[model samples]
Target: SDRKFKEILSKSIHDGHKIYEWLDTDEKLKLTRQLAHSVKLIYYLKLQQQLWQDYYDLGIKDGVWAPRISK
Candidate 1:
């Protein structure tokens, strides 16, 4: 499943508007959710890092941003 998901992402990235041609409705929904989660994670991390750096530049010593994942 992981390999297949990777292939879908790769092809979609290169082919641009071809995801509908490659996946059915259910598959499209699943892939969209996965992609959205990934994008949110990346945005959160980047924003956290920027905020931490801002605090550090302002001379705040305890501005450490540590990420912990819990299932």
Candidate 2:
């Protein structure tokens, strides 16, 4: 599952135009759920705590930047 998630994420980032064009709303939701589940698993593993912390920080930053970016 982790491997599949990473593969999708990598494809999204590396070939975003093609990926986004092909991905539908349901597929996007499924991917989001998969990513959230993966994050929970990583938290349980206790090996990616700092990475999770950084992701949280970035989420905060993105929220702050979102309004400006949307314009």
Candidate 3:
């Protein structure tokens, strides 16, 4: 999955238009959701990493951002 994700992202960066030929409608729908979820996850992960670094720099031990869970 990681390999596939990297391939898609690399293709988009290098040859954005060519992805149309590689993906069908259904595949596009599924892949869009997959990519969106992955991107959001990576974004928050990076944000968290930066936050941790900032906290470390400030000598703040317990500062963190926690997402809320819903039932």
Q: Of the candidates shown, which would achieve the greatest TM-score relative to the real structure? A: 1
Model 1, 1-71: lDDT tens digits are 64466465656587745655556567675877687689989999999999977876665445454445699
Q: Residue 65 error for model 2, in Å? A: 50
Q: Report the CA-based lDDT of candidate 3 relative to the real structure.
A: 0.68
- 1-71 in candidate 3: lDDT tens per residue? 64476466556666756655545466675777687799999999999999987877666445454445699
**By TM-score, how accurate is candidate 3?**
0.48
TM-score against truth, every candidate: 0.50, 0.32, 0.48
Whole-model alpha-carbon lDDT for candidate 1: 0.68
lDDT of each: 0.68, 0.64, 0.68
Better of 2 and 3 by lDDT: 3
Per-model root-mean-square deviation over C-alphas: 10.3, 16.3, 10.0
Candidate 3: Cα lDDT at 14: 64
Question: Tens-digit lDDT track for model 2 on 6-69?
Answer: 4566565756555444444666758776776898898777867777777778978888433335
